[model samples]
Target: MSDDLIPGDESSAADAADAVYRELLERLGEAQPQPRLGATKRALELLGNPESSFAIIQIAGTNGKTSTARMIESILRAHGLRTGLFTSPHLVRFTERIGIDGERISDEAVARNWDDIKPYLAMVDAELTAAGEPALTFFEALTVLGFACFGDAPVDVAVVEVGMGGAWDSTNAADAEVAVFTPIDLDHVQRLGKTIAEIARTKAGIIKPGAQVVSAAQHPDARQAIVDAAAAVDDPAVFEGEEFALVQDAVAVGGQLITVRGRAGTYPELYLPLYGDHQGRNATLAIAAVEAFLGGATQPIAEDVLAEGLTEVASPGRLQLIGTEPTVLVDAAHNPHGAASLVAALGSYFDVDEIAFVVGILQDKDAAGILTTLAPAASGFFFTQSESERAIPAEELSRLAASLDLPASTFADTLDEAAEDARRWAEEAPRRLVVITGSITLVGEAIEVADDREWKATA
Candidate 1:
């Protein structure tokens, strides 16, 4: 709320660019469930179809898409290929949504691309208005920017994480060489569909002719939908537990080491620095995707490269331990399934005397379902709101937490204060932990603050 808190460029001042972005998203939400791909198509046309400039890997799922895309990008780079990764719902910086060879797109680069694309965005809006159609959405504009950035980066391959569902998502403009699915579930019901079969049908829209498809183990209906989709295009399909699987997974002091046996070959004990047993499945899916994309290459990837690449990749806000002694675990679990995974990971991986949580859910998410899963594991709850306006108010979230019989407190109207309170509560208990979950917006804000502090110290 302070003037100094606003971001600025040389010519223009920032009055909550974050707030402006959130407002745009809110406006888009007012028009949600518009599953038509026209806006994306129009935006791509105005931008000269930049997504076609490179080979692409399209990844889609209800959960784990970001993690899987990051892993696959890392694996491709490990093979000595220049890779570009485009993902969504960034935890911290907007530049995190687009990266090349593990480096985030520079702020200057993003600003430059924004300048380059602004006029096209205006034209698209004008055209849509002329046609009496809804204007380009925040996600649609951002997806165009992603394509432009990747086109400018000019990497050999671009790994795109589908925003929302795969079929009508803006990123679907690109013809991907491979399509990956990571355990589809019922999350985005309104836009995608109500049932698993219907949702799978929408997600399966990303599959193109002759593209190799690699999917994690799926619900029966979902799996059948994917099968039907691939068969329609004559695509070679690899399914987890049938064509590939995690043969073994073990945790150690360093991190998780998982052996993934794909249809092509068995990847032995790939050490990933990420925590959680769920990550084992993610790593296996990444490996399977890489093998499918490589098309049976005779040259084997060096063990050192695979191990080093897997171990070194960074996935923030997914069971990240931010503070020691009264430990703080920050995870972006925005839905029931994700919250369940976090609960399982916490119980299996960390040993602590007590667990406290700073929890908040957005209006669009499953608040009751998330709380139902998290409250059983959490000893205390510090309910708060994310920076997003769509965030459910703290009092409502507190009431929801009360339904679970969890000791809960609603803190100062914001996530930062709630996180501080959680930290304070954890400080009082021996071997205590404070976890932040339920929304990526909260995770992003927390990580941005941590990074800013680190930079100030070094500055």
Candidate 2:
């Protein structure tokens, strides 16, 4: 096909792409999660099973999935491989979820690929309707689109992050060669399960027969579930702090320095340009996962390549510093465990005497649990809600904080107002900090507001 004969002109491609994205958003209005592999499987089969064309690594857990997936993609790309990365709940652009060769897929590519797959998607919709099943969901369609894009890119490997629980998640349509699990917690109790063991069992479903499984140290119940799952599949399983470990970590200027005892060999003095000890642990898991993927825990990656990959790793909306001089940091800490990690990282890394938090949370999350975890480090709170329909109202959050005996104020407006209020509170003192957190959507909004206000880090 000639360039002139394309569906839209170059200047109009963005609008065309956005229209396609809007159609995908319309699928979310139903919100009826078809948590099964059937829809995605059928869709991919129609697309010629592009997911199987490339080597796949699947990462699943309550948190750190996106960060670990990014790390794995970066390390694999550093090793001179073309890598495709599919992550969920993008901070900004829809295109952020799909990456090829270390960069997000372009809007033009999104438009072109959607056009190419539209017919096959329609076919799947018809098939599902005939079977008295609902059509493909927003996530299911997106998963199929990502696989098709990866196949078109002809990437050597693809790092895929599960959107939710691993078993029957849309991405599970692809059998991964490597299955990685981060810490499993009690966040998504309504969908996954109510207990740690139940959640771990749901997550362990990602481990396929003959696939290598790498996991973080877990609670006893969670650990047993993973071990049992691996045993059932006859797969080799490596757990952090046992098979591989983060040997040492110290706070550095911009981020942290760590040494990892990988399954293959001990890697020392790796500079990870991200904060938090949890991140250091995540880096160790990423290294071990890469080691497992390349070879079975015995072959070592080149030191320089590993270092370069770690240096280039970026996990935005996760304790990301957006501004300084009355410093502003944004973290997507929606649950108690994540909130505790945020508070710990703040205490260990930054020198702020006090912190004012701009907090927003989803309706289903444990607001009291999060506030309690954050209470130790928080000097004040600015409660707000993100754009998500599921977010709790700011006044409700403020009331919850009051019950918890935490000093709180309510923005009851936009996240921008909450962020600015927090910033003003921080500006009153020389070494005060403003932290925008509690939800990923809130952190994303804070970042956008910071960018618009030209708020650069002055430190």
Candidate 3:
């Protein structure tokens, strides 16, 4: 065999990145998803515990974790600090999970880091194997990789969104300085818990001793659970309604204008370039978390910095409008709670008379509940699935919609076809909208299709 055939061959950076990504995919395919912390903690330990090199803000919740995390990262970066963001379930590319200074990690960086850490990862894998535990899952490995990348970047702060329940999640291995919860509800019941209280309790585990815990206004039971958790740890807990709130919000052109009452002071007329009162609340929570992280509520961020941060922030696939003419929007609202938020946003933001919804949901989600919540806003439905193994069949989803007395049609083929059909239906009726939603995977696929068709309108 030639020298080039050796593992340390003279491959281009892109080629090396591709090789590393392929190996990651292989590991991802074999992932067993054992929701435990041992594997990840061990891996981090083997890698010299890169997660401890920087301060961390861990955001956990059912629906808005990613959006909130993104907002926090943007705000912190606006403060002129080098920030690292680690979020899960990337919409299109794996690189989306790790960002430094508001940019996705470069392929060369990923490859270089992976190459540097491969031996350590292998050592951890062998240790786990010898201990009779399964190897690190996809998320676990990715979490370690993200921490390593962030350490190599030498970021001042890292904003992390929990992949699953906060306590045992792979990312939880990092001791977060600030733990933020955004409107926890019933989600991942099979893994988290069956009740809102149970889920909140699981999420509240992210609260470390002396950590400043920030939570959105939650249901009474959920609130109690989080409060109890914080009390147990002797941490200072701040709740939205009691400590901070969206004082005023109005639908604005492009997005929404709002006033927020933070722990220290009130900021008014902040324009967040994102739709929905829910998003407004998310922004408030992010602001509060950042305040707590930088200083307690008494220290407010510079007014100019806060305004620039909110203005520059963007949450793609969360009530995002990707097209015009016959307006096409996409949202990743898979659960009933998220669906309710989507429905509210649709009613409050857009003036369309009707909406043709192209929905695809995972098998585990409450498809009926989602359809029920969205039924009032939808004129018709085109049921489709994403390129996910867990996606429910289009016919099955249509049947579910029909049972709810919703007008439904099946597009079992592809998101592109489903979108085209929805667009045509919307065009047939003036002032109508076309929406692709229900599953994040579906929204990601639809976004790809929209980009390919040049359907995305420039701002």
Candidate 4:
């Protein structure tokens, strides 16, 4: 199963990569994640364990994992290291999930890696079927693909983000030198657990023996779970609000000016071109995670190099401005925690007095919690559903809004219609903004529309 790997012809690379991605989609979807790593581990083992080829910084959390991982990869790349980043639930294309040197993994690379790894992946799939188990899932196969691509790139370091709860997440197959956690909240409750403590313990599984741990501040139960996990491994841990912190953040023109006390150094008043105070905290964790990984939480990052990295990081679909004129924006805030952050950012960052919300929630998410969180800030709701099979219908959101007595809202079967209607409504009023939230899928589609229509250039 090892390489006699032939390179793919570049002429048909896009078609070939699309076919490979479709095959991955044919497997179980990411929403139905199998809580096991055996299949992925087997596939990687056949590929001669490419996950071990580079140093890893595995991230686990309810939110901010992608943003944090992106920041970490940017910082490491800025320091002149060849870096690989693996994130999940791509907004535009599958290629967005894997990054090499701060750029998307190319179509050519995807096709080439799939050609090399397909034989090994097929071998694992056959083994599982024979044993009366399912084949590798979408996430599981994608996990192997990310590692294979990174190994082929032969990167200096890889920043890996967990697709779900840490214990059995396919990415956890890689033993990280630094196991990092963002705030553990009640997301994917059915898959992870019902309570915060249970979820935190499962996420803390990334903390292997001899691995260093870094974390954001957590609730008491979550904090204890991480502390226990680290103690059990006898590894050192540095928690946010204790070891390092987002010392200060103020609204800046494009984003924010922030100060961070990293594990090793203090980076004062850096310009991060991203919205939200949550993002400032996410950067703080990224800085500390990098400090812990590169310098073992002892040696400070050069201030100029650190600033260079922070300024270059862009996390699309999270509090992003997709349009202007009528001032349309999108935030991938699927849960109450994220929705709350969006509300706070709106108050702190923009001058809008009222917001017309375009929201879509997947079937498994807590729609009520999200609606409740946004209700206080909403001028009205344009209830809509994403194209995802998991998305709840637009009427469902309308019904939820009624149940909460929030407002009289309108429903749109398609995102485009909802956005169009919302924009028109916003344009008629002063200090009114169109803000899309409640799911990544909706936000991604909104972004696609914004790009196609040239929303920034035209009204």
lDDT of 1 at 19: 34
Q: Please tell me which model should have the higher lDDT, number 1 or number 4.
A: 4
Residue range 1-459, candidate 1, lDDT tens digits: 223332445222233334335544643552253566777777777788888778899999998998898888888897888889988887865667889778987555566666677788888889888998878777777788788888887788999998888888878877899999999998878777899999999999999997999999999999999999999999888898988899998887756879878766677878788888888899889888888788743445567767867987878789886665556778999999899899988887888878888887889888988888887787878888887878899988888766767665565587767877777787786888888888999887777655553412221
Candidate 2, 355-442: lDDT as tens digits: 8898999887888999999998988899889998988999888988888888756665788777777887888878898888998888
Q: Which ten residues in a row have the lowest lDDT in candidate 1?
A: 10-19
By lDDT: ranked, best first: 4, 2, 3, 1
**Model 2 TM-score relative to the real fold:** 0.97
Model 3 TM-score on a 0 to 1 scale: 0.95
Best by lDDT: 4
In candidate 4, position 218 carries an lDDT of 92
Runs with alpha carbons beyond 4 Å of true place in candidate 2: 1-11, 29-31, 457-459
Q: Candidate 4 regions off by >4 Å?
A: 1-11
RMSD of each: 4.3, 1.9, 2.9, 2.3
Clash counts for the predictions, in order: 1, 0, 0, 0
Show model 3 residue runs off by greater than 4 Å. Answer: 1-15, 28-32, 457-459
lDDT value for model 1: 0.80
Kindly list the per-residue Cα lDDT of model 3 for residues 1-459, writing each as its tens digit.
221233444356557666766778767442246768888888788888999999999999988999999999999999998999999787887888899999989777887788778888888889878998777777788888899999999899999999888889888899999999999888888888999989998899898897999999999988998899999989999999999999999989999999999987888999999999899999999999999999987798888989999999999899888888789999999999999999999999998898888999988788888998888887789988898898998888887777778875666667888888888887787899998999989998988888889886667
Pairs that collide, model 4: none
- Quality of model 2 by C-alpha lDDT: 0.88
Where model 1 places Cα greater than 4 Å from the true spot, the runs are 1-33, 296-300, 407-412, 449-459
